[model samples]
Target: MRATIKDIAKRVGVSSSLVSLYLNNRPLAARIAESTKRKIDAAVKELNYAPSATARALRKGKSKTLGLVVADLCSDYSSFFAQTLLDECSRYGYQLLIGITHYDPEEEKRVLANLIARQTDGIFYALRLFPADFLKSLNLQNYPILQLSSAAPEFQSMELAREEALKQCAGKLYEYGCRKVVVAHESWANILEKELEAYGIKIVGGRYATTSDDFPYLNDTPPDAVASDSSIYARLLRARCRELGIPMPYLCYSYSLPSDFIDDPRVIAVTVSDYKTRLSGIVSRMIRMLENPKEPVAHLKEPVRLMSLDELREYRCAQLKDPYYEPFRIRIKYEGN
Candidate 1:
């Protein structure tokens, strides 16, 4: 049987109320003598006493639970974000409940309704779709919402610093002597075409097929380098290069590269937005809002960095050897000497 506050109090020859006060760090606890406090601590250690979270929630009339909604839990980006938020919530004495929407707007609505029904203190949305109309219709006065990767004027958000990251990437490509570059996604190509034009590096091809079957055209005309917003497109580019019996060109990735690409020396560089730091800030801000409902809503932007694949490989290898190893500090590379 689990030990209770009464059991620890009895063992320490103190009253249950006194034990409760000390455990909860109440104002009265400060008045207790040092020796008495030490005795109570020793008794708690001996009994292996743990406070009941459910009981405390009932007394306080607040459920210490956080709801996290993701587009897809299977994706590496979502998985990493979810795990980081889960750890942060656990540290703050809150439990996390996850909901996966698979990029469906209706499913997202259902998930949000369920979380609200369950009385989650706050909701963290990491979904792909940002339906402004739906968000505006919801009554969010009671439960605060925070978004990642996307933005909505209705709630607080931690958005990716995309423009700066693109500038850094274009600078790196220019420094590497890339005269012509092929960008994979049309949306990013449109943005980057303009960004790289100033550097005199022409965009040879703005759109390319991501699948193996539609990539034969790359064999006939290969550019100096390839840039992509998605790691999926980057992977396809490398695969197409291999299939054509041609050397892979210098590759620049916008987001986190796939795990398979980390060890492949063909991938020269990648741009990564610091998700851990961004999520930490989000969780802290959400907790503050939950504690004080009158707190002003704010927006946050996470900085992105350009790093070499070789450096990432070394860092990942070291981390794999030691489970307690801290995340490797990113060394940002610039264009000029």
Candidate 2:
């Protein structure tokens, strides 16, 4: 039979309530005599007593479980963020329940409902392509919901510094001598076209839905470089380049490239957001909100930087050659218009 609180209490010559309070680390338990505390600890060790998490949660009215929903599990960015969030959750004495929506609205709704049904105390939502009003309509009731990347006035969020990251990426690309560049996403292309034009770089905008083989308007005129808002698009561009037997142009990706492509020399530059820092901040904020739900919603932003080809290569080399080398110290200038 498993050792229980009553077992420890009986061995320590104390009340079960006292044992419970001490085991839970309640404030009142601190006032107990050191000798008595030592006796309780010794008794617990002798009996190999373990507290029941489920009973404690039931009494406290908290599940101690956090639900995390990501836009796409297949993407390296999402996977890395999810792992970081998991580690953060474990540090705060919470278990993580993860759900992947693959960017589908119906799947997202289903996952959210399922997580709630499983009695998750809070949720961390990280959707890339969600509609602006989608989260507002959700009836989260008393549960705290924190968003990553997506934003709304009703919930706390950690938003990406996309425009700044883009400017940095453009600067790095220009430094690489990319005079004409094709931006894969229309939305970002629209925002960045004039910005790049001001830097004397011609810009060609393409839709996000374009495929590697069927990219429009590229047959006659291939740009000197291809830039994408996502790693997926970057991969597609690489595939297209490989299929045509043409040298892959100087490529710049706004998001971290997938691990397979990270070392590819053709990928001239990338914009890397500090996801670890952002996720840690969000986790800390969420824990505080759980402790006091009435706390005002926080809007946090993390810094992003562009990594040039030379810097990336140097980092990769350091990883292979020097065990003590720190890659974050390498610096590059941002000169976008």
lDDT of each: 0.73, 0.72
Off by over 4 Å in 1: 1-61, 177-180, 185-193, 202-220, 254-261, 274-276, 313-337
User: Candidate 2 lDDT, tens digit per residue, 256-326?
Assistant: 32242355687877777544456678898889889999877777777777776667555444443432222
Question: Per-prediction RMSD in angstroms?
Answer: 8.0, 7.2
lDDT top scorer: 1
**191, model 2: CA deviation in Å?**
4.6
**Model 2 vs. true fold: TM:** 0.69
Give residue 166's error in model 2 in angstroms.
Answer: 1.7
Q: For candidate 1, report its TM-score.
A: 0.68
Residue pairs in steric clash, candidate 1? none
How high is each candidate's TM-score? 0.68, 0.69
Q: Give the winner by TM-score.
A: 2
